[model samples]
Target: MSLIVQKFGGSSLANMQRVFNVARIVTQTYNQGHSVVVVVSAQGDTTDELLSKAYEINEEPSKREMDVLLSSGEQISMALLAMAIEKLGYHVVSLTGRQAGILTNSRYGSARIKSIETERLFKELDAKNIVIVAGFQGWNKYDDITTLGRGGSDTTAVALAASLHADVCEIYTDVDGVFTADPRIVGNPSKLRDISYDEMLELASLGANVLHNRSVEMAKKYGVKLVVRSSLNDSEGTVVKEVGSVEKMYVRGVARDNDIARIAVIGIEDKPGMAFKLFSLLARERISIDVILQSIGRDDTNDISFTVKKADLQKSLGVIRENLGMLNAKEVKYSENYSKVSVVGAGMVNNPGVASMMFEALYDADINIHMITTSEMKISVLVDVEKAERAVNAIHDKFKLGEINS
Candidate 1:
């Protein structure tokens, strides 16, 4: 029997009926002569509700205690799912993250998996019992409970799949699979049958919520095959593997991220080691940066700008202000009202006209490109928040991605 790791997101198991649906699917996979391991997120808005209660009690909750309280959401779902499977006449065992041997670093909220010990899990599988593990929660080195950061469950599923050497890791979500573009944004975005892990990573970062970026990186590192599919339907979904020469899609998808902020450090003398000194200070403060651009300013000065998550704006700006001597910038300007619009396609790497077309599309719409970043399969541009929707629609239509897909 082959081993398969299946993960269901919160939306896929939002209610008792949905719980029963997951149980049926697990049972079917088990009966098909496969050892099934299922990882599940917290049921529908339960985690959020828990966080709300914690905030009500304490504006600033301890990360350790917060994790302890938040992890219960997935635990409840795991137990209920196990019981549901038992009602369907199958042997099943429910294990929390610690019980399943998910060992992670000591970070309370945003821990990363160091390793996985599946000995107990293998023993249960030997006895032909289906194992259901709570996702998003793991144990620190000291055996204290901790929750991985947002989108932790996806990382959990991919980690488990890597640990078990499963043939494929199936991600069950509300939608059928990864589409050429977000179906909601672009009507009838083509459903991709298969895509490379690189393309999928771009899509995830751009705005595809089907899988998390951290999970995709793990899957890519471990050479694990991942499938994104719908739990409510019998569709085959999309297969994500290493890119192959055989072509199936000219452009895979487009993603737009509205939660973006850009910071510009202007009028710095163009001297050696200037950029390093400024960035090192921000790195020390743990501010994540994306899409950095440096250009020569008028009169021998330089302009450096970068993007960070909107929530980090105050902290990041604070650090820069504190380290102004190190940055040596005449002024630090930031725009909180900015958005990132990205178009992802595998063929962009080979086509010289892709960049030209993208720029022309934005130019035609009179949308200013603040910062630009490109990858083998994706191009992201920053624009004014008010024009974000128009920018996406313009690029989508300019590439004629809609016409090409439908």
Candidate 2:
């Protein structure tokens, strides 16, 4: 029998019926003689609701308190799932991140797991019990509850599988698997049979929303096998690993992220170390930056424009204002009406003209591109938010990705 680690997203266990459904899934796996360890996200919209409550209580609540509040969501899911499994006459135990030996850094709301103490987990597995562990959370060195950032549950499951040396890590979500484009947007986008870690990481990082990039990064590091499947059905999902044997497609899929904002620091002194100092201020606030563009001004000044998640716009703006004079910038401006559309595939690395084809599609669709960035596996462009869906569809059609099947 193989030891298996399974992670279910919130959409998979949103209600009691879904809870029972998930329990049956777990038990069925157990009946097949696989030792099962399940990691689950908080119930449907639980984290969002908790954030709303926290913001209602205080505009800027302490991160520590937020972590405590947010971490409770998964605990509820774990306990209910454990009870559901027990109802089916299976021995089960539910453990919090701490009880399961998950130790993390003291980053509170966005802590990175440092190490996992698997003694307790092994004991329960050895006892022939299906173990239910809360995902996206851990205990820090200060012993404070910490929540991994968004999509952290994926990381949790992958980390657990790596730690336990499980046969494979299965991530169950509402969708069947990773697709060429969001099927809802690009009708009948093809589902990928398999994807490589690097390509998947690029897609996830560029906003695929299937698997968290951090989880994929960790999986790549540890060589953990991961499968993305739908809990509602038994169809084969996507297999993510080191390599795929199929002939590589020019573009595997497209991802569009509308949660983007652009910040422009107008007329900053064009001097050495200015970029570093200015960005350092944002770093101090823990803001992540993306797609930096610097333009030469008429004289000893330049303009630096960059993109960040829309949610971080305010904080990033604040940092800019806080350091405007120090960096000798004329003014700071930002726009929240932009979207990031990306095309990802392993084949793209050795291929040329993909960018031109994407541009051609966008040109045909009359979608205007604002900013651009590229890596070996993907190309990302910023465009008007209103045209984001059109851009994605046009690109998907350009590659005829819908015709390619997993």
Per-model C-alpha lDDT, please? Answer: 0.88, 0.92
Rate residue 301 of model 2 by lDDT: 93
Worst 10 residues of 2 by lDDT: 244-253
* Residue ranges of candidate 1 with Cα displaced over 4 Å: 244-250, 403-406
- Report clash pairs, candidate 2: none
Weakest lDDT window of 10 consecutive positions for candidate 1: 244-253
Backbone clash count for every predicted candidate, in the order shown? 1, 0
Task: Report the lDDT tens digits of candidate 1 across residue range 1-406.
Answer: 7999999999988999999999999999999999999999999999999999999999999999999999999999999999999999999999999999999999999999999999988988899999999999999878799999988999999999999999899999999988766777776466777888888888888777888999999999999999999999998899999983325444566788887888898987788998888888889878888999998898888999999998888888898888777667788899989889888777777777878888898999999988889877778898888998777777777766666435
- Displacement of residue 48 (Cα, Å) in model 2 is 2.1
Badly placed stretches (over 4 Å) of model 2 are: none
